[model samples]
Structures are given as C-alpha cells and as structure tokens.
Target: MQLTNRSKQVSNKEMTLAEKMYLPAIVGGLAITISHFFRKKPTIQYPEVKKYLGPIYRGHHILKRDEQGRERCTACGLCAVACPAEAISMVAAERKKGEENLYREEKYAAVYEINMLRCIFCGLCEEACPKQAVYLRHDLMVPVFQERDEVIYGKDRLVENMNDRYIRVANSEVQATPTEPSLTRAAT
Candidate 1:
C-alpha cells in the first residue's frame, strides 16, 4: 500500500460501469435544478413596485410645526442623545416674546441638523422626540444617489410640504392644515 519512491503511485481501484454512468447523480442534480427553477422569485421590483415598508419604518427626520406655525421641537436634545450614530445636532434658542406663536416650547432649536449619511434610520430620533415632531413616512422611498455631498440631507430636504399624504396624516386636525410646513411657508 506504501510506495518507497517519493513520487505518488497510481491507484489500482476500478469503478463500476454504473458508477461511471453517474445516472443517480445526474438525476438528483436535475431534480434540484427543476425545483429551484420552479421556485417563486424573491426579488422585489423597486420604483415600479415598491415594497410595503412598515408604518414605523424610519427613513428621515423632520421637525414639525403646529397650526399656529409654532415649532414642535422643544430643543430637548433627547434625539441627539439617543442617536447611536451621533447624526443629530441642535442648538437651543430661547423663544422670543411674540415668538410664542412660532415655538411650541420656551426653548426651541436654533440650529437642528441631522447628517443623513451618518444616520442609521433606527427611528431613535423619532422615538426621542417627545413632541412627536418626527416620524418616518411610508413614502420616503426616494433613491439616494451616490455622490460626495448628495447623501447629506439637511433641514430643507427633511422637511416636506404639508400637501404630502404623510404630513396630512401627521397633522390630523382641521386647524393644523393651514400651519403645516408644506402648506405654509415661513417668512425668511
């Protein structure tokens, strides 16, 4: 069984004609191929056929405004603290005397920002907003083009028009319609 030479020796083992034919192996392979071919396709066609994302699915963040055009963000910094990715940043600003109609709380966000590229869309921002100012809309399936700075969505992009169906649902009140960001533009 051992060869004295370092060179390998050829085996004397012989295969049966049936083994050479490989009929069983071929049949089994064909059966597996057929089953796979007949199996349902699992690929989701996007754009034309968007997958039904859950209602709570996190996509983007938005700071909401009330019917009187008051900012819903209390500048609580809860979202900033909760974000694992550290994508959120905000500066608290004191609500001015007449600005009470523009701010829901005494402390409003003077500068609220979310680095979309850094955000994980974990919904923590939405959850952390005590004022319910942020929510992930089902329609936020827009494709993100690859570029140096294109992926970073700012307050302008995060904020949508009130006409959007998702915004309407969020408003959920007759008085809220007029003041919705999409419906009314804040004076620059």
Candidate 2:
C-alpha cells in the first residue's frame, strides 16, 4: 500500500529587521487592546438588573398536589427508576382509611428525597410520572448551598403549596380528572 502526501508547501521568506524585533506584533496587540477599550461592554448588572429566562427553562423540581389538596404521588418509584443520575429516593407506605383526604392513592410516599447535586435537571423524573405528580418548575431555580446536606431536598422542600403561583401555573397545564364535584364544576 502506498501513502499519498497531500500536504501544501510554503515559502520560508527571510524576516525584515523590524519583523525580527516583533515591533509589528506588539503594535497589532496594542491596536486590539485600544479597540476593546473603546468598544461597548456586554455586561449585566446581576443583582440590580436580572436577565430573563425563557418559559421552557427547567429548574427546581416540585411534588404537586391534587385539587382536593391530596398528594398525587402513589409511591410507584417510577421517578426514581427513570432518573439517570439516581438522584431520587422514596419510601412507600399504605394509606390509612382516614388518610384518604391526605393521599390521592392507596399507596403514598412516606418519605421522598432528591439530591440536587446528583440531579442533572434533565426533566426525566417529571416525564416518568404517570400521575403528573412531579414537575420541574420553570419559575424557580435551585438555590446555592454551602453544605452537602443543604442540597438534599426532602418532601417538605419538594412539595408545592396550593397558594404558590408556580404550582398554580403547573396545575393549569395538567389536565387531571376532577375528584370533587366542585372541582368538576369549576373546570366546566
């Protein structure tokens, strides 16, 4: 087998005294620096003037509730299984007879947690949820934390309040079957 040399040849011209001294290169660098000094800066005043994030931007995760104020998660473990980073974990428990008002399903998550450090914010958990119980909130971003433990979000932190604007926005997009007659009327 023969190898072909497809390389281009260049002429090696002798450098002038000024070129050899690198005076042209120095002047070129100075010209670039001076141009940048006069040019408009593309800087945002972070604290005072916030940059706007688009509507589809995914951020913090939230455990949603039904219209009746009951937890929609059935502790199916689907979210944990679907998470590529293995950031989610939950303990399942059977709902008590009197706890129907607290849980939407017979099985409920006794404990649910997500390690934010391990999460890639890919929205896989939200997509895996069949009940539409989990959502990655577009309005809220995950806050910076100093300690490792502070990044681990428990049910208390993940659960969205009924009055929360983000939760209301999320719920409005989800078409859930009305559990109550009043909710059915309101939807109509």
How many clashes (backbone N, Cα, C below 3 Å) per candidate? 2, 0
TM-score of each: 0.64, 0.68
Clashing pairs in 1: 161-182, 162-182
Q: Write the per-residue lDDT of candidate 2 for residues 55-81, one digit (tens) a residue.
A: 555788899998888999999999999
User: Total backbone clashes of model 1?
Assistant: 2
Give the candidate number with the greatest lDDT: 2
lDDT of each: 0.66, 0.80
For candidate 1, what is the TM-score? 0.64
Evaluate model 1: give its lDDT. Answer: 0.66
Residue 186 displacement in candidate 1 (angstroms): 36
